[model samples]
Target: MPTKSLTHPVRTRASRGDIAVLYTVHLDTSHPTTGCDVSPAAVHEEYVVTRVTSVAADGAVTSVQDTRWSYDNSSRSLQDIPGVAKIFVIPQDRVDVEAALATAGAHTYPDTTVLRPYATMDEVCDAINPHRH
Candidate 1:
């Protein structure tokens, strides 16, 4: 029997008057095990974006973009855990990009202390590495 494990909800919304951009992250894990357990684990992460047509009407959805990342670790090693950094090129006007990103920063995972924006995955990794200095 497989066990249902970790679930994380991440949501972000940015709006200027009637138009809005929303971003969300969903993580699901199955067959997870602790260090003492001798089983493997599977994890999936979903990233979604929804463009709002109107804020007054409870933010009707005008467009959406969804992407996913997944990994399997049978070694039961903590270092095998997958990294979850994604770059989304939203097709909105240039004026809206900053506001949208600001909203994303405000609604990131509570445990995250720093929310620096990066242009590439390598930059993100470098910023988070403790030994980078």
Candidate 2:
């Protein structure tokens, strides 16, 4: 039998004609701390995908916009994946994220650090929305 993967879904604030659902998965990693017989440290990472579906009063889905993001444990922050920014849905939040990433230079992920921003949600939505119409 194959193992089953679990995902959690959260409802986002919706407008009169649409309902948004966010689905999340947690990823875990363990690495040895130091020295002989030292216990490993467990780290948790998150991946989130959201679907904003436009619906009619009869509960029919007319359109859907999906987006995704990943958490960077070393930076202790969320990072948007390329072409998927609406998963966060805020512009100022990205500014704060940049500041946090800058201050997190002291931290290393496997001896290196990398932080960058993906496209804005509006850009992503615009690119994909054309296909839906």
Candidate 3:
């Protein structure tokens, strides 16, 4: 994942060059490592946003911009979305967009990227790289 710190431009509003996060409620994964598991291991699966998109748009999403800060690992990889790219025309429904969004996390750094509420780097490292070993 990218830094948990907000870059301001990363607000959830799907704008050009903005990293839009898609919340996956439960994604079955075949992670390369056993310690990489994100499953709940019990009730509901974990809610996570792995991939992010830096969209390009005029009035609405038009393309995926190749942003340098968009990735650091597999989970933070940028997705190439053809449907919303400038090459294809998709209808915009502002009302639906408004209805679908719920802003979370505190904005910091600048209005360059919005970091969603997630575990801090130290917390994450502690979880994945447990001391039990």
Tell me each candidate's RMSD, in Å, in order: 15.7, 15.6, 14.9
lDDT agreement with native, every candidate? 0.30, 0.29, 0.29
In terms of lDDT, the best-performing candidate is: 1
Candidates sorted by TM-score, best first = 1, 3, 2
**Candidate 3 lDDT, tens digit per residue, 33-69?**
2565554542222212122233444333323322223
TM-score of each: 0.25, 0.20, 0.22
TM-score between candidate 1 and the true structure: 0.25
lDDT of 2 by residue, 1-133 (tens): 4422211212233322232222223223355454454432333323222333344465433333332123432211223322222332222211232332233232234555542222232332332232221
lDDT of 1 by residue, 28-76 (tens): 3456556665342333333332233222234223232211111231112
Give me the displacement of residue 59 in model 2, in angstroms.
6.3
Where is the poorest 10-residue window by lDDT in model 2? 3-12
Clashing pairs in 2: none
* Arranged by lDDT, best first: 1, 2, 3
Residue 45 in candidate 3 has what lDDT?
A: 26
Q: Between candidates 1 and 2, name the one with more favorable lDDT.
A: 1
List candidate 1 segments past 4 Å from native.
1-41, 48-89, 111-133
